[model samples]
Target chain A: MSLAEVAKNPAGTGQKLKLQHLGMVYGQDAESVPVLEDINLDVSDGEFVCIVGPSGCGKSTLLNVMAGFLPATAGTVTIDGEVVTGPDPRRILVFQERGVFPWLTVEGNIGFGLSKLTREERRQRIAHYVQAVRLQGFEHVYPSDLSGGMKQRLQVARALAVNPDILYLDEPFGALDFVTRVIMRGELHRIWQTERRTILFVTHDIDEAVQLADRVVVLSSRPARIQDILTIDIPHPRNISSPRYLQLRDDFFFWRNPVAGRDSSGPSSQQQPCWRYGISPFSGRPPRSFRRRLA
Target chain B: MKLPARFRPVLFIVLLLVGWQVAIDRHPAQILPGPIAVASGIVDLLRHGILFKYIVASLFRVTWGFSLAALLGIPLGLMLGWFQRGEMAFYPLIQIFRPISPLAWIPIAILWFGVGDSAAIFLIFVGCFFPMLLIAMTAVRNIPSIYINAGRNFGLSSSEFVTRVLYPAVIPQLLVGLRITLGIAWLVVVAAEMISVNSGLGFLIVDARNAGNRYDLVVAGMVIIGIIGLLLDLAMRSLENVKSFHWSSSEE
Candidate 1:
């Protein structure tokens, strides 16, 4: 079947992903440290969910569990009522490091997962997505020759070419500079609108979450559990200057900040509360206890 | 004034020839032949048809020995690298043998093959095998897990995974191993020819020294061997010049 038809039906027609009491613990006995706890979430089909959390939070572990790279310690994740076993091609994960194959050219990487297609169909699909990702002249060029932003775009194209129903992006733009990151976010948002794939993106950037997500899922620090799930009622191509946009963004900032837990007012501090956390919003070392991570 | 890089080697050779002529003027031709005498020796051999015969004999032995080494070593390496159990069973034995030089294998080769082309080829094979095997094993082991994961996710069959993913990933480094092994094989064949056979460059050098104490002929044989080794290295280097193979080393 064509990717559009598959996207329309998806693996789960109604509910795309279901997580219940999902918890992850590393090591055994006294050494074992819990990374996630009592996490329960239900995502609808074709929804764009942005999961925002602190730096050391278990967002990545949760994404890995959902992508079937890691197994949950306590609970189960089901898609279409079937428990997740291991990584499936139908649910592709886009990593931040630009996982485009360095050995292969742009076309080669895009056509990597298109082995099931007939030769002609593979060519057509590869061409379509290459254009979709806006990499026109670089089809024959190796990824090493491409710019950093171009390489990441090529990676996104490779993921989309497979026509996966769910795209799990783990800080896909985290490595890029500010300008490129903004541009990438716009391109990604446009692609999501066109493809309508269910995306669960993890990031520490609240502005990014506010700009892109249909619903933002806020996560607490280590051994993270769902703090709150705020629906972004603001429309797409949201004006950052608008009162409603600033209000929604600050609302997320207030919920995540520990200090904000003290005072319910002062939404103005929402300017960029995510930059510095746990200490004063200005600067100083985080508490020694928070800095020490177990190996 | 500085000459171009290509002329530097030619200039060095000319200066060496002038020095050799001066040295030969002071000494008798019996003990040390001059460049002129060595050139005459080479011409005489070529006129007598022995030059082509010796060159062909050495080339033939090297081709058989090095080809066999590569055919066996590369696959064995891939297997040992791919399967941990295979490596566990075989690697200790390889480690034991790898330290010994191919020259040490000369006695065993003579005993096994009994003074012929087979003995010479066996020595060359011993010289070439271990380096190729180790390099190929390293190449396979060094491949990033991401590539394997990508292969699996893309639905590549096990055979396709090996041929398409593993082979391409391993080849650039393997080519480097092949070049080094070829150099070793060339070195071994000469020594092997000196003892076991009487029809190669090595045999020519030994025969020239022993038959009539023809020092000029011996020097000529050494010169021929050096030139041929340089040509083979150049041929192998041409593979790296190819654009597709060039970028492979830069890949993660």
Candidate 2:
């Protein structure tokens, strides 16, 4: 989704986040390890994109590069025609709940980046976000006092309170239990629909990717490269048990070439529980998607 | 007999006094005064206004010296922990001086300040300074990296980061350092007063023995010192128990 295409296409005029030939390498000389190679991605404004891969697949490294926390070894990440050299207040990265300041209360965390605002303005903004995140009564409570779900919500409120144009979340809900995680996904989707800020969310869960993303980007193993990008055209208020949703979910398992010679149709004994649970537990082989919704 | 917690200490003291009286019966009065004699000595000093004056004098020196040390040491430590170059330049110097007892500084303090309250206060300051510096430095260094990153991400400038994040983060550990340094400062001041000053608990003990072998007055001076040190420690303990500091206490 290039800026030119977005501009020519009257339906979308919002700013596009562009990444060209992004490459990142760690260490030096022989010890130098490549984390990302020949990566190119374009995210249109107001879109929710999820990058999904196995645990050690450098998905987070890619996010850090895009967030301007780590520099790309080779490439330029530009937004609205300006190259990103460092982290800007316009694009905030909401780290795992660990990033929330334990020393601060919910109100304090929300108001942390609002130093530019007047006292009255900061107060109103903080109160609005605290209530928006369903933390109205926990204003004076510290992160340590909050539960996992509440803390993640507090982090979201803190990030959203800053009013950034783009949000980069790194496995934000990975620490929550299954039920809480499912609930949080709905809350995030609701918040995203209401806020309409461009979000690039990183997660390893296939179900999570399918549920929340407008486009789910699949990446190959170490020194990750985009293997496929699948567009989820399903409307919101999505039903997980609905045939279309289950088809898309199961499609990921088929797309992910599970153990080379095995038949893709029947669920093997090892995969039966995962299929029952609706979350593939195994790190199936990297997916090969025939449907490249966006190139 | 059963006693309330508050009365238990009083009962224990009464027993201690009775034991002291019996122990002193085997010795001459000049060698070890009985508890009754020490009580009379305390009353005489109080009536003459000598005990209160000496206490006030000692407290004045301690306050000045401890305040001076705290004012200087904490900032120096904060900088040392924050900047690698500062640690490189000053940490070795701190390590070298920390082990040398403040008693060793007494001769130099007298030579520099010339044998009065200045000499005693200098000794107290030296005793208090190193602990404050080291503890504060460690406290600053121990603040989790996540806090620092969060602070910066919020667009806090370098100075704001130090003042807003670093200071509050280091406070709980720093408070413990303050209480310990004060105890050392009080201990050092007394030793300093015994050698160079004219009026303090230390001076009272020396003067009682020198003027007329008043063992009872010397014993009374010792008792006062113990009680005062205990009180100061209790005050600091209360500060550590405050709600904001409770989080750090759990780590210990």
Per-residue alpha-carbon lDDT of candidate 1 for residues A1-295, written as tens digits (9 for 90 to 100) = 3333333333334687999999999999999998999899888778888998777778989998998888889999988788998888888888877477776889998998888899999999999999998999889998878888888888888888988989999899988898999999999999998998889999988789988887778877777888777776666677888998876765554443332334333223432234445433324443455333210
* Docking band of candidate 2: acceptable
TM-score between model 1 and native: 0.84
Q: DockQ scores for all the models shown?
A: 0.40, 0.35
Candidate 2 lands at a TM-score of 0.82
Structural similarity to truth (TM-score) of each candidate: 0.84, 0.82
| Candidate 1 Cα misplacement greater than 4 A, ranges | A1-13, A23-39, A52-61, A71-74, A204-206, A217-230, A243-295, B23-32
Off by over 4 Å in 2: A1-15, A27-34, A56-59, A219-224, A247-295, B1-38, B212-215, B241-252
- The window of 10 residues in a row where model 1 chain A has the poorest summed lDDT is A264-273
lDDT, candidate 1, B1-252, per-residue tens: 999999999999999999988898987646678999899999999999999999999999999999999999999998898888988898888888888998898899989999999999999999888888888888889877656665666657888888768887777888899999999999998999999997999999999999999999999999999999999999999987676666665654
Candidate 1 chain B weakest lDDT stretch, 10 residues: B243-252
How far is B177's C-alpha from truth in model 1 (Å)? 1.8
Per-candidate clash tally:
0, 0
